[model samples]
Target: MNKNIKHILIILALFASAYNASAKDYLITDFGAKADAKTDNTAAIQKAIDECSAKGGGKVVVPGGEFASRMISLKSNINLHLEAGAKISAIANGAKYTSLVMGNEVQNVSVTGSGTLFGNGGKFTIGEEAPNRPYIIFFKNCKNVLVEDVHLLQSASWTLRLFGSEHVIVRGVSIYSHANLNNDGIDIDGKDIIITGCHIDSGDDAICLKSEDSTKRVTENITITNCIAASNCNLIKMGTGSIGGFKNISISNCSLRRATESPFHKWADKPDHYIGIPISGISGIALEIVDGGVLDQVSITNITMTGVQTPIFMRLGSRKNPTGSFKNVIISNITATSHSRMSSMIAGVPGFNIENVTLRDILINSQGGGTREDAERKVPENEKDYPENRIFGWTIPASGLYVRHASNINIDNFQVRLAAPDARPALYLDDVKQLKATNVKVDGEYIIDKAVYKANAVNTSVNQ
Candidate 1:
């Protein structure tokens, strides 16, 4: 056995021990659920779950075999346990299966085992003839939920999504996707969540958080740590659909890399298209507050990345919604090797400026071959358009970092090293107020004239 599988088994053992000691376990095969990979066992599994629920919150155990099902609904106080070697492959018809497994308004629910879930993502397409596929696992308005020690593979859409849930803990879950479009690894639209000790490789954003409810219920108190992620899109992202806002979030001890083994890599190349739609290179972290969301008191630290297009990308705009506030962000101890097509940027709308942002102990090694014309390019006030890095033209005005329409920014022990010669400055500051940079280095030395550029910046100081 390999080390990673062993670690997953250890976590599975702990989870199984906790739930097995309390629930009255009922094996699915014993309830007449066929193990044939071609048979639809949805009714059998539903009967088994019903029986277990009637017996006062027990476990519906799926033994080692291949079971095919369309959609499985989980009830409160029930534990759906899949043993080692067990596989649940989705078999849906018409457009798409509603979902693989779902939990709605439930409590004390768990899904844990050293098993696998196959979503058959490649079978779906994005053309007009294809229907919008469903997610692998979804939880809505659920409480006291847990999902651990599972191999989630080839999801049709967003793999695992938690919406309006609270007090959720997900650990030791591995996700490998890259079959279809918009295959985000995990989407957390909940509060009081913890996602740790996981590995994710996908075609889109790996770990993303959002708040899209109409009740004005914000997504808050989210912590994601000790995970490794690779994606063709953003590794970590929040808010392109921010109706409720996000607050009190922290991400640490994570590594983000590019997915070189994606079957759809050609579709993600620069100026490439995804089966007809255009695509962009991946960003290590992408943060945006475009649709009337409040983003504040967020901290990201201890992130190491490689083969990324942009190390960090942030934007705050008003698009079809009221203007929102974006402030109080701190990013520290981030080291990255990034592509130089575009610089890491932090920008806000014309009248709405990002405020109170800080960066500490940051280093980026970029493949910079930017020309003077690229530096002199006009930056448009793309306030109402979609908020993303590549959408701000092919290349930004700066080679290293760009800060526009922001205030009260500070950078400490920041360094940028270029791989190729370029005429553009390393850092560009525009329409910034009360900016301070200390111990900032370019290449191996600190040269302000050759590195930093300022326009319409007030009260800015680089430490001498």
Candidate 2:
């Protein structure tokens, strides 16, 4: 053999050996960590993590049992693997670490395995006037992160959140946080993130995406797929927190439903609060770019939803300035059932029309109790207000779909049904331009009251 080739082969072998040597596993129990829930294992667990990080990083194994602990910090190149039937129960006090598990500026970190992280949320105060409670898992300024196969329960705030992180994968996790205030399942405020094959039941938004930062941050290259979201609030929501822009997002194969839980049975507080909703008074899928952020190039498909006030909501609002815009959105293959009072709203503020939106292969079944009085009522722009479906205050003019201040909008293969009596039009368009609706049907056989109602619309066509 050539001597040069032999030298290269020997160098590769040494590198592999060193890599394997650095990736050692450290058991937390070996470092004076107790498995009994009665004992405080915070110091012992932190010691184990510090020692493991000192050893060039590796797995910090928490074996099966109940470990009562405060916040645990994770370091670089560490995998915190919880064994089956293992639980890490949070100590019911102070906001020291701000979360049960936290990572900051770390690389190659992961938390995996069939275990549970319970936050004991009853110990928390439960109103918006209170301070923001900590999440179950909160990480920031990290990279190459993974969270898989874990169950998170009863967070005082959001269940999981990532801010300013990259290359994150969260899969096969179950999050249930409906017992308290701001109980969102997951909030991602970063780039290159994938959340797939997860189940989330929450009182707030499930799978929320935010780009809220003082300085500009771009939330790009994100994908969410094959997830089940049960929520009392919006099932899938992006941006009422858009200080930065969002780009290149795709969401597919998702299920959205009202959470099957009750406040009396689940929470048992003094004043009854609903933990979950049998029918959500919120939208199923909501997107907004209100706080001076550009939102563009989003695609959502294959969505199934039920028991929502509105099936979809899209808004390019003006609550803050620079006055951001939204464009180039595509929605396809959506099936939804809703107790719609205000219709599925899609509108941009004046002078900032949401541009180039396409909806294809959409089917909606809605409870239609809208009267002619409600239909004739003019909808408010509410540009400076917080962006929400109910923020408009009253019912919209349409029973099925309502759109305003848009351009180049296409609605194809769309159908709607009124489950109850509705005097409103099936679809309403106002201040729209270059709109087209093909193969659109409403009320089974009718198209407008039967067709569409248009006002100040230009260059529009509808073929039933």
Candidate 3:
């Protein structure tokens, strides 16, 4: 009955009232969706979403059942919640999945659950004899979105794709897609996005942040953290698209493991088709501001890799559209153990170059053998139709780091040892400027290979 105690109690009561007013729930099973022991309850689930959206945005609950459906489009202010043991399996037929889930400028939408969304991709067909078509779970132009605690398994193509979205959070999601071809886990083409606490084992790049398509805007302010990625083409990749550039991105606290057996040949017609494509291993952490865009302020830190082919690989060039230059990139605290060659390169057009790049605290353990002959092979003449070939060469020299046509580069605390003494140099620099290397130890010696290092004509420093 004290005055101060009464005042505190009154404040607590007000806060509880506010919280109750804002919270809402919508259950799917209540809306004529029977979780019968045997039934394809796809239509019933869709009905629940329609009713929930009509009722002005609440949770669409999918209880424990095998709900088979094609696509379920999400609405504004709606949260699709899947209860434990609940599974929404995609129909195998492409016609069944013909309806795409459209999210055009919808705000405050979320799909969160501790359940599974299975893309029965094995049933779809792609090429003439291709077993199944590539089906994707795609989101486009949605803002303030959150997708978490879901498992996407056996997706045909890219498992999860976000395009032109903002303020999106994808966390605690596990995607398993080894059976399907080109099963990239998450393809992000959005801004202000955070992807964390996920595990992706895919056929292609586990996580790819693409900025192709010159017409679309650049993707910026993206962060990927606390993830485990394995059995993919590249653990984390960027810029293999035809449009859109990326900036202000950070990838940290992740472990990437390359599968020893080749996964690329699964989708290839002939065994020799993708032989030298650099398909296996953590090929590289690429930052290519190429094809017609500017890439700036990107960093990759605290990454550990094992059984990878190439520890570090980078390319910068202006081949297609003249908008070039990769600026302000830092890669630190990377450790790799592998048998293949370790290589990194930065090359670009005449005017634009890779600039202000730093590599620190990198350790690599490679087999004494040279670069794999297959890895050194050039792009096949048949695949010249691709734009990537026109932009950059097929074969990259086998070395610890190769720099060409770059400026303001720093290398510090780098230690690399080859399986044998016949291995290539630890560092190779050509036609670069303002380059400095400190505390770089290789094979128990400091490498000063003048053949690769060059001082620019104007400045006294190397390629200044």
Candidate 4:
């Protein structure tokens, strides 16, 4: 070989050796750590992470034990693996646990294994009573991430939150929260994410896709499939915190159950506050393109839900500064049953209306009656305080589904059954243009109520 080629071969050999060394897995118990299940194991885990990072990247194995700690930080090229039977529990006291795990632009990182990460946060107190704190695991500005096979329990806030991340996968994880005040299971505020095969139960939204504020940093390409969400405020909700809008999202093959909160005791010191919000449903699937952004190309299909209030809700508004519009949305193949009253609304500002929205093959069974005379009594009450609130959309009575100030809307194969007799119509559309309802049935009757179509009527019909 030539002299230059020989030198290049030597350099290549050195680089290959370094890569092999960096990819080697490092054991945690080797660094003077005990998996005895009683000792404070935070230091040992941190030491293991430091050593693994220094070695250029590797797996830090947590052996079988109840390793108690908080805020476990992950570095690049590192995989924190908990072996089967390994239980890493967080300290119960708030002071003992760090609130969050700060990410440092790390890539190729994972927290995986059959073990469990139990946040013993049920013992902590928030507000007057105990409130769930933030996430048990938080990753910010990360890439190439994997969090699988972990059981997260009893979080005060969201169990796992991914913020500003890319190429992320969350699978086969179970998250549970019974306290229900602020317990959301997995909250995604990033881009290019897939969450599949997870079981989530919380007091609030089971899976919330959100953006903190409106900065035009859109969250896109999110796919959620084969997940079970139950006993949540909403099974899956998008944008109560949508400052920046969302795009290119799909959700399928999910089962949702509206978890019934245990009745509150009047004599108890702290009573649960049930605020009446539109999105506070058992299987409430909402897409609100509010906060000055555009929501486009969103689709939801093949959802089976029981014990839900409102199964579908979509609202678009420029609350203070209306920046964009909501267009090209579709919802199909949804089956829902509810004991609570169902309410859904789609509305926009005067100039900008929700456009190109479709609802198809929906079957709902509601126990609560629809749009009673007493429900319309709120109009006069709102006029007493703020009369302008009565002008926008308040004169329109509440219904199972309310569509106001929208255009190009279609509702096909929509059916609803009430448990009791004398139930009203299930479909309510008002102030909408270019609306079509084919094969729409309410209690096996092909009827279109004139009061629902009296607001802004244009080419509205129900085909038998």
- Clashes (N, CA, C under 3 Å) per candidate: 0, 4, 19, 5
Q: Over 4 Å off in model 3, which ranges?
A: 1-25, 32-40, 96-102, 126-136, 212-214, 259-263, 266-279, 282-284, 371-398, 444-464
- Candidate 4 lDDT over 196-254, as tens digits, reads 89998776678888877446687888888899987546678776666677899889999
Clashing pairs in 4: 126-130, 126-131, 132-156, 180-203, 231-259
TM-score of each: 0.91, 0.91, 0.81, 0.83
Better of 3 and 4 by lDDT: 4
Q: Please give the TM-score that candidate 1 achieves against the real structure.
A: 0.91
The whole-model lDDT of each prediction reads 0.82, 0.82, 0.65, 0.66
Stretches > 4 Å off in candidate 1: 1-23, 127-130, 265-281, 444-449
Q: Which candidate, 1 or 3, would have the higher lDDT against the true structure? A: 1
| Cα lDDT, model 4, residue 297 | 92
Per-prediction CA RMSD (Å): 4.8, 6.1, 7.0, 8.0
Per-residue lDDT, model 4, residue 101, is: 40
Once fitted onto the true fold, the runs of candidate 4 whose alpha carbons sit more than 4 angstroms away are: 1-24, 36-38, 96-102, 128-132, 260-281, 318-323, 371-400, 444-453
Error of 3 at 130 (Å): 7.4
lDDT of 2 by residue, 305-349 (tens): 986778899988888776888899999999998864767888898
Q: Tell me the lDDT of candidate 3.
A: 0.65
Model 2 steric clash pairs: 447-450, 447-451, 448-451, 448-452
